[model samples]
Target: MSSTTTEVLQRKPRNVAVNTNPEHGLHLVESDVPEPGPKDCLVHVRATGICGSDVHFWKHGKIGDMIVVGENGLGHESAGIVIKTGSEVTRFKPDVVFFSTPPYDGTLRRYHVHPEAWLHALPDRLSYEEGSLLEPLSVALAGIDRSNLRLGSALVICGAGPIGLVTLLAAHAAGAAPIVITDMDENRLQVAKKLLPRVRTVKVAREDAAKDLGTRIIETLGTEAELVLECTGVESSIQAGIYATRFGGSVFVIGVGKDFQNIPFMHLSSKEIDLRFQYRYHDTYPKAINLVNEGLIDLKPLVTHRYKLDDGVDAFATASTPGARAIKVQILDD
Candidate 1:
């Protein structure tokens, strides 16, 4: 190995953000820099977007059956530079910016070892922050692909969170018209309006009936939505999406929620609305990267807040706080 590679390999005491337990929440812990396996690449993680799933794990201790056993690192949406590649690695070299997801310990750390196959090289034009956002953008693209969104197809996005907002951008770029986004928080709705000035925004209340909210969504669109991307994962929002979708329309569930949710099954059946669930993303990174590189979609506006790796706890707090109005909270190594 070269002297530079040896030096990077010897870097010590990496800072990692971990969810110790429900009581402790997220905090930084020092760990020895990990060495890459034969097919792994050691990455100098530059940016990691705090995902909603990470927050859910921190707040609730788990999502469904995936319990946080012991100390669990809590980030997945990440991009970084490959400082050292394993012996078998040939796809990437040192100093290449790439987006990656480490299967076990998360990427909310300065140094991460990721499998070579899992890494996708990011273009020079995109910042590490923008590259970190590809995971969520991939999700949005997957939802759009599943929706089969056509030009001028009326659509309803059930939540104005990061995923919902990215979906909004993807759908807009795909030529979906009269897109309406709903959120209980007026601040988030305002952000959505700012992201897409022509899009309609709706302020919803949890106490209000789902059917009523659905009616309001239809009214805002002036017609039943051909596609409803349910990003909230809330039972009420799912019900509202079901009610708002026209006959034969699709309701794609992209949000992760409780193990079981009560829904208006009969209504969904009667309306013949296709209820599809999104479990992360599948083979969308290339398309997502191309979209951003081609200027068809922009992910920069979604990063409303940024924090250094040492302030990981504060970053999670800002993301979890309702009043913070942070669309995407990113933790940076620099």
Candidate 2:
């Protein structure tokens, strides 16, 4: 818990995001903590979660147009206590937790400043680890919202990562029936089955997932899918979701894919299915907090490992490697 400054500029070095190159991984260097301007709150980060998107940036040095940003502060999913509140700040106390920030200097630090709009007060039942996951959770919930999940509806979600699992959790809470989840990773599928019992877990590769899931549901239930939530962003999986969906069904694209994949839209066009793209969340934090408060989504078991700020580089490495047996990797500063 020692903090000093490097004087990269004239200001404090503890707050500088020095990763300008996307190809290189992050390093824990010193930079200045800028003073909060009006309408901003200074957050003393306690925990920051390394996301898969961060891993892609670390390995490739770019995500679409948004690069890691030199010395790239590598974080976005985070939670922390309020240290300094700007003149216009409201809606949170000093000890509250919040999340879903895009890592400009990331939450892996002693102090950082952000707008009050993104901060959501953590309920007593939710931990900082859970709070830090609001971003991905929003991606899940947004899929549910856009797909119009309702009682007795059927949903097939591809890629049993955090977003897929959370989408399964939300679908169950929304009273969707026969929720189906698919992943090639047996371990991931097992974890999802144990953590979330509502979703029927299936092991299907991108090549066979569509016909596999579609055939099973089509034969057993005698009905096509009402909605498809594609959480993998893999090309074949995207086509799988599109093909498996019932006529006039909706597909919500929630994963962060930096590449383009060939999606055979013949089924979509012939079936007249609706395909919607869901990007980074907007106006979903409060509902996310409420969802956690109302017991709609349980995020406790989602976090598989924890590391410290100094080990952030390894955290990204861990997040980048799927075989590391990590679900949601978190970084703790307190």
Query: How much lDDT does candidate 1 score?
Result: 0.85
Q: Best candidate per lDDT, number? A: 1
Q: Which stretches of model 1 miss by more than 4 angstroms?
A: 1-15, 22-24, 93-103
Which residue pairs come into collision in candidate 1?
none
How big is the positional error of residue 116 in model 1, measured in Å on the Cα after superposition?
0.6
Worst 10 residues of 2 by lDDT: 1-10
User: Global lDDT of each model?
Assistant: 0.85, 0.72
Query: Residue-wise lDDT of candidate 2 within 1-334, one digit each (tens)?
Result: 1122223224443552313254475666776666778888777777777777667676777666665555656677778776667888765753333332234545556577878776777877777777887767877777888778889987788888878877877787888887778788999989888976656766775457555656764444345778888898877777767776888888888877746666667768899999888876677777887888787788888889898777776777777787898888888876
Q: What is the TM-score of each candidate against the true structure?
A: 0.94, 0.87
TM-score: model 1 vs. ground truth = 0.94
Candidate 2 runs further than 4 Å off: 1-20, 94-103, 206-222
Error of 2 at 271 (Å): 1.2
